[model samples]
Target: MASPLITLRENTIWENKHGTVSITPRSLCDVWNTWVGPGVSNGPIWRPGLAGLRALVAQAEAQNQRIRGLGGAWSLSPAAATHGIMVNTKPLNYIELGFRDASLDTAFSGNPDALCFAQCGASVLELYQYLEVRGYTLPTSGASNGQTIAGAVSTGTHGSAHSIGSMQDYILGLHMVIDGGRHCWIERASKPVVSPSFCQAIGAELLRDDALFNAAVVSFGSFGLMHAVLFEAEPLFLLEKSLVRMDYARVQAALGTLDVEALDLSGGRELPFHFEVVVNPYRVSRGQRGAYVRYMYKRPYRPTQASAGGSTWVQGDDVMTMLGTVTGWTPHLVPVLLEPILSAQLAPVQGVAGTPGFQFGAADLRGYVMSSEIGVALADAPNAIDAVIDVANRFHWSGFPAIRYVKGSDATLAFTNFSPTACTIELPSAGSPRTLEAFHRVWDELRARGIRFTMHWGQMMRENREWIEYGHGARVEEWLAARQSLLGATGQRAFGSDWLTACGLG
Candidate 1:
């Protein structure tokens, strides 16, 4: 018998940096670089591809190893899995999208699979760019464009808009590989039917049940390998990015009083496209316990260079300033330099920046993360700062990253889009042991508060049952079913029941 091939390293999806891990992977799946669990630690594999994956899956099956898939690695909960063969689908990052003539929904009536097909590894940024270039757009996406398509939808990512559903809403279907076997195509029964040949085209059984579709679309990698995806896209347009930075008091004042009813707005101090808050942990000692709110305004998509006399917008290069690899330098030195960098970045757009068309964060985040990030939902945006402050008080999250908000949904996989407005707190920190404790403590505190929240499916987070019950509940069951149905021929398990067992779901 031949020994299996393995890539070993202590890696992190945070800064897209390679680090050490406890176990070695036979193959990779759809996880972010910052992913961590039993079979994985630190982050996603450097670069994962199709052949590497098939060989890995074969090896795992032959060796009786459990197989699981991950994306974004954002879920702080254990849903991504702790052990076995974890596949990171990032290297499959090919995105070629072309939507059906128009809003397929109007023609099909809320059925998913109304548009183009995306390779499982495509990032939200990649998809957004594809659509923007073609004059199409996705319904919603997380603030940062780093998450992979599989990770975003599997974890039930969402965007703001009282009328739209979460990422699941736009998913017409996906190409998935199951633990028991190979890949398959999935869609809601009501949606347009895909050919059996198409299903077989990708080594999967065709499943089109509503319950199954609903469950699997946000399966959190428990179902199986998400190889490809098909989703609807809207006509391309621009969001003026009515950006606003607000104080903590104003948001709280409006919360109970409905004063801050609108999470995204332009100037009227409302209707923002992108909304976020930045928490300063140590600053609390200086009478700062809350976060700063920043929101965006939606505008038309008109391409023009800022230097060419158009409005200027910050790109990934600008945000990259947030993570400078000038290591060994005094800590203060980096932030000091960054302050001016960010300050200048905030300046109005001057050069013509073309990202597909109308959009923000055009940079692909498949491997984007300065460090590990933990996302939490806050009962009150104003009060949410304490969690970060707690971590900061402990000296974790040394370099703070801004917190972003997106109107959540009722979907099982969404992080914040719920009936009540929730604040998504993202604690960005270096993947150092010193800060891990602080991250855990802050996460535990938030969980104890009975706040109805979920962690990013792409990043590290707690995995207790309580998080699962509130995170997605029976939805996980449905997700499992969807996986089983899709992998009908192959009786397998990706990430095994670790996600379920950890959550006491099984």
Candidate 2:
């Protein structure tokens, strides 16, 4: 059989969407698409594509070069970059929508029909369209659909779904190409999904260990090349959204308490499927309309309802990009200038509804943006916000602060691992030096107040052992051990990146 097409572009420079992180790698390896022919019974349909990925790893190993799997390139951090060859996984976009009953383990209890086998390069938008047509939907996704499945899961991408956890939570299994072209299928031992035969069909060894599975799920390509992922999907559903401005005092109590009754919305009494709050730190005074509150209530999937449409003001890239550009011209005027711009852009919109796919549709490329996401326990949200506001007061902040709540994740390195629930305070701003300076101060202030927090892997962070240990503590050691066991010393060297090494994970 002919090998799948793989292209090599030498001396290439890789930059992310926000232009925050860039890498000039030795070469860029593009893993082009290869059609999968019909398989006999349970044979793997993705043999050609899988072999191509394995070859890329083998080649990297032969040259003693590090490899980093590149996806949507949506991350602001260098988590997806490497000093050696960067494999462009975009063409590895094959997806199998549902699992067969014959492919299931005898002990598996979940519905096989709801599972999806997606290649690492399959963008989240692709999965959204594929599943919606089949009357299914992902439980939760980041605010936008630009990120690939592997990229999103590796970095523990999240949305404001208070009930459901981050993207990694739905993943059932991992198909990885580790050192020396070897491949394996990893799943939780306590809750097996695919049978051993299924692993054999895919030419992968089956390892059902919870610790290994948790570590691999959110390791950001450090566990080796995540060729594909098996994730659980739910019956399709719609969301009724309401984004409006409210008095700062009215929503202040709900910021930390999460008391559903605090701020009046259409989805009253019952808990919302998604809840978020965006505040202008400079404008928060009693009786002033300084907070933008958004609530998305779950609704049954109805064929008659229009397909998901344009995104609400949930994401901050567009607004932040503009702020960043303007701040370049008037660095000192940011304190006086950003208030109206924020107030207008963050204006209220009532009774807008759509599917998760439509509501969180493709995001626009906002250049020169910087975002730092800090995850704290839901109970400490108010104090965290207070600290951020305090910093904004002292510094000329060029951006606004948005608060989102997500259920804690089981993935070992997931930032939202705060028990019960996590409140992620996202500081999206321009890439201005002044704003960047203030961003670091936010971290220092949080620590000074004795607030426990974790930083998002995909966003900006203080790249140091101290910050990582402070947030993750013993979990960092557990993750390092898992990586050490699975990849060994050789595999770790091949997959390790400068970002990981700087953070002391390497």
Candidate 3:
């Protein structure tokens, strides 16, 4: 049966807001419109929504064409772009919270109320609003709440939560459409969430394997089309945010060692829910206010609590606004243009409190901005920052570096795979050829300095198989082995893309 939810247009040019990735596909397919609630529906509205996605996969296979799923189009890399068929999944926004007693496995031990089943297209902001009203919330999300749930998790999106892991860490299950349009409900064998009855009712085969689950959770869309995800949500809480400016020398000690006392926040030795440091590369000398520090402490939820309003520094989705205005790379002009903006935006704000949704809210796409994130061991962060600063200054790059720490993830392909904790340094700069050249140089310089690092899959970086292997080591082979075991030869080729091939993952 032909699903009415699927629409295909020929010869469409798909371009992202950042202009970093542009693709003119043979066909652009929009996969969904109306949200089909649970239960088998014989109606024209497409009772079983997976039928459309499955049909798209079969079409791609039969025609011998590559197909890729497009989410919020938030990725700076060409990860989602394909020359054959591009499916826009933004309309697949559907949220189902809580599970039925019969639908859950008897072995399931976690709270069912904390479980959320969200379609691939559902944005992070939507989930935030949906859960907040029901007295629930996600444990963590990226700095900005713009990317779709599937895209964010698959790419290993993270924020400054050293205690908590990346967004993918909370995921318990994945509903995916694999090779030849075969749909399956995948979860960890050791930690089963849904029962076989649930899978049967949803018209999916049940497969509980930890290796497959971990690989698919952060596989960057190579596994197949992610129809939906089941993630563990937490009780609603507030974040008390404080932003302050300090000299580079003052915070150097705390960079490698995450001693909360050294940060000098109101909480003293108590660790923060979120911690990040933004540095102006041009002004890293002693006594200079080059570091802008932000810390958010967890607070009990209160209905009477005043909103903190939306004012955050460079962290997640949005680019550096100051660098976006610069047309060319001019070292002299960069400091002159940056200092005033930094001074105004980096001023201290204390005792402001809000929910995760309010603190990290909507962000507009900046086309002129480009970002490259590198993850290294927590203890190696100070040295990494120094390396980046040197490269930025020498290259005359018109941007700054922001440091964030996250607990290492168990996901096989996660960039934040460093043991204990991973410190991620994000460089957001003007989108220029010279800036890209500088990024390539940074990768080389880091390698030369023997600083082992991994690049974010969704962000801008020089793609090299050797670099990927250097960063991930044996995890790459483990991920590939999992893919081979799950998808087999046919599905691997169907889901493979140029980007995946470039990184040696395909």
For all predicted structures, in order, the TM-scores are 0.70, 0.95, 0.94
Residue-wise lDDT of candidate 2 within 1-506, one digit each (tens)?
35666788888777888888877999898886553344423325566667778998898888999999989998878898998989988888888876787899988887788889999988988888888888988899988788899999999999989888999998999999998889999999988999888887778989899999998999988999999999888899988777878777888888887787857788676768988888888889976788888778889887745453344335432344456555556666666776677766666677666788877776666446788889999889989999999998887677678899989889999999988999999898877777789889999999999999999999888889889899888999999999988887778999998999999989
TM-score: which is higher, 2 or 3? Answer: 2
Off by over 4 Å in 1: 1-22, 27-59, 69-114, 157-166, 179-183, 190-204, 242-246, 254-266, 281-291, 305-359, 362-380, 386-401, 410-413, 420-422, 470-506
Please report the candidate that would top lDDT against the real structure: 2
Better of 1 and 2 by lDDT: 2
Q: Which residue runs does candidate 3 get wrong by more than 4 Å?
A: 33-48, 304-322, 325-332
lDDT of 1 by residue, 1-506 (tens): 22223354323232122221233344334333232334432222322343345555666666766666655554444455445666666656666554333423343553333366776777776677666656667767655566688877876665443335457766777766665345556677777546565555345577667766666676666666677777767765555442333344445444322334654333555545544445344443333333344444555656544211121234422242344333224443443354344334343332223332234453322212233343344345444455555556565444554554444444444555445454455555433455466667766665676544566654555556666556555665555565565554333443454556655544
Model 3 lDDT tens row, 155-189? 89999989998999889999999999999999999
* Candidate 2, pairs of clashing residues: 308-358
Model 2 score (lDDT)? 0.84
